[model samples]
Target chain A: LAKTTQPISMDSYEGQEVNITCSHNNIATNDYITWYQQFPSQGPRFIIQGYKTKVTNEVASLFIPADRKSSTLSLPRVSLSDTAVYYCLVGVPSNDYKLSFGAGTTVTVRA
Target chain B: SAVISQKPSRDICQRGTSLTIQCQVDSQVTMMFWYRQQPGQSLTLIATANQGSEATYESGFVIDKFPISRPNLTFSTLTVSNMSPEDSSIYLCSVEDGARGTQYFGPGTRLLVL
Candidate 1:
């Protein structure tokens, strides 16, 4: 299984920064690091994806170094609504590529 | 960006009854995926629904329990058979992100078993 490891849960204050890191030591060459944000009672939404270095979008930014051993998701100036679970997955589908899911990091942005 | 939708936003069904969740994509897609997420848990890929072929289920999922159908490129359905309390989850459908090899999910269907 191409698994990922991250903190079980995290806490932050409103207008603060939140950074979640995921470690995938056994990631493959073709694997792409993708992050998703999931709220209560809702599905996971695509946040960002990066192969290496930094990839930024309107929602968040993903930083992946050359080693590819780990990646970080940065959410700037978070609000209470920004509280959600974040998942880091490595790899893409070609022939039933399995997405091994762990208990994602629950980020709570408190007021 | 693509828009994906799922039917039956929320449902409460008695045990032993079945529920079929529908997923529709605004545009044609190359690959579709089904996922199950329990309360306070991360998303689990239930199966990979391919157009014109059988659904490829994950390790713990069985086709008999979670039947998936991808009749075409733009739509798919997942049926939870012989439902139990364990079947209660947020069922979601996703499409492949062509450029980044990512998966974009729908709003999802929330199912609660009684």
Candidate 2:
């Protein structure tokens, strides 16, 4: 499993964009970068995932550099309800692979 | 995404007692996992519940401490034995959606040991 490092916390205002970056210097070639959002007392929800380049979804966008050593999760037009802990995991997506979660970045969306 | 449910959403248990948390998925899944989240801390993988065989536990976790059972594809249970105040945390279960290439988690079971 690859170790990941990210911000401890971030503050963003409503209607502003929030971007959280994660660095996995030892990321493997078979590993994929995935992001999950977790609300208070709730399970983590899948936000976006990408192997390389940029992948956009309705909820968020994932940008991966060619080196694949780092990835960014961009949340556009944030709202107060978007405040949550976001986790970035790097691993192979398979039934046998267990996800290792790091100290996630807590994004506080203020009004 | 799979609809996952856990039993006894929250419980307060006495020290030395044991609690079993049940996890059920709407559809069959090949993999199920148990995780523990302490207050103000990140989630930790407890074990991987394998059907028909013994579970594979992670480092710092043992089968005697955090026993897991996966009788079938859609259901699994995790037993916390010899509980203490240090064991108080939220226990969550997750299933892998191979088709979606992601995992979905259940509403965690909150346990408070007194």
**TM-score for each predicted model, relative to the true structure:** 0.91, 0.98
Which runs in model 2 stand beyond 4 Å of their true positions?
none
All candidates: DockQ: 0.59, 0.73
Q: Give the TM-score of candidate 1.
A: 0.91
Query: Interface RMSD, candidate 2?
Result: 1.5
Best of the candidates, lDDT: 2
Measured by TM-score, the strongest candidate is 2
Docking class of 1: medium
Model 2: per-residue Cα lDDT over B1-97, one tens digit each? 7999999899999999999999999998878999999998899999988788899898999989988889999999999999999999999999887
| Pairs that clash in candidate 2 | none
* Candidate 2 lDDT, A1-111, residue by residue in tens: 899999999999999999999999999989999999999999888888899999999999999999999999999999999999999999988837589999999999999
